[model samples]
Target: MDHMLRRQIEKIVPLTDSEFDHVLSFFVKKKYRKHQFVIQQGDPVNYEYFVVSGLLKSYILDESGKMYIMQFAMEDWWFSDYTAYLNGAVANSFADCLEDSELLGITKENKDKLCREMHKIEHFFRVKSNYGYVALQRRIFSLLCNDTQKKYNELFELYPSLFQRVPKALLAAYIGVSRETLSRLSISSGRKTQED
Candidate 1:
């Protein structure tokens, strides 16, 4: 499990064995069952979590109780309410497990301390943040364009396994479409549905 995190970090910056161990020391491992909340709305957000296995989603609910998924984090992915975590504010959104999960969480204080102690660690996070920003921009563009089919196809191309793993209704929500509309799109595209 530790090796998984090391692999992810090494993708951006190479770390020696001792350095990896030092970095790992700052994180605390946690496990959660499916449907369990990792971060709930109105609660303080403390840690940014790295998934060792399983899946989780971060989302918000509107006043009318409509859910809008911000992002999903699967194995090797990192997630948190960055606005809350970085600013030391309460979470406006929730993060919950989509599957039984193992994660490594590093608190904001520990993260800052680690970065201060290791310049390479700071570089790693900066690069990761830039990538996250680019992805966010692309998602914003997709939502603004109002092209459901394009969004569906782009998601399918990027993460085909999500079709198998995620419920159709949740996928619909993520793609900004109604479930029935998503079913139609799936049929039109000849893609396998979650039921299959």
Candidate 2:
């Protein structure tokens, strides 16, 4: 599990064994079962989690209880309600395990301390933050401009594993389409529908 984190960080900056050991000291490992909530709406956000295994989805519910998934965090992905995590506020969204998962969580204080003490770690996080921002922008652009078919194709192109792992209904929701519409799109695109 620690190796997973080391690999992720090494993508941006290589770490010495001692450096990796120092970095690992700041995180707490946690496990969650499928469908368990990692962070709940209105709860104080304590830490941002790095996925070591399995999947999690972060989402919010509208007034009428329509769920809008904000992001999916899988192996090597980082996830938290940033607004709350950074500001010490209550969460406005919920993060739930989509599959039984293991994660390493770091509180803001620990993260700050780690960054202050390690230049390479700080640089790694900065790069990661930029990537996260770009991904968020791209998602927003797709949601605003792309038609259903395009959205489906883009999502499939970007995260093909999601098709196998996530429910069709959830995929439809993510693409802002109905399940029936997604099924049609799947068939037309030569992909298996959930029923198939």
Candidate 1 overall lDDT versus native:
0.92
| Model 2 regions lying over 4 Å from their true place | 193-196
Model 1: ten consecutive residues of lowest lDDT? 187-196
Q: Write the per-residue lDDT of candidate 2 for residues 23-126, one digit (tens) a residue.
A: 99999999999999999999999999999999988989999999888888899899999999999999999999989999999999999999999988999999
**Model 2 clash pairs?**
none
TM-score of each: 0.97, 0.97
How high a TM-score does candidate 2 get? 0.97
Assess the local accuracy of residue 175 in candidate 2 as a C-alpha lDDT between 0 and 100.
85
Model 1: residue 30 alpha-carbon error in angstroms: 0.4
- RMSD over all Cα atoms, model 1: 1.2
**lDDT tens per residue, model 1, 20-93:** 99999999999999999999999999999999999998899999999999888999889999899999999999
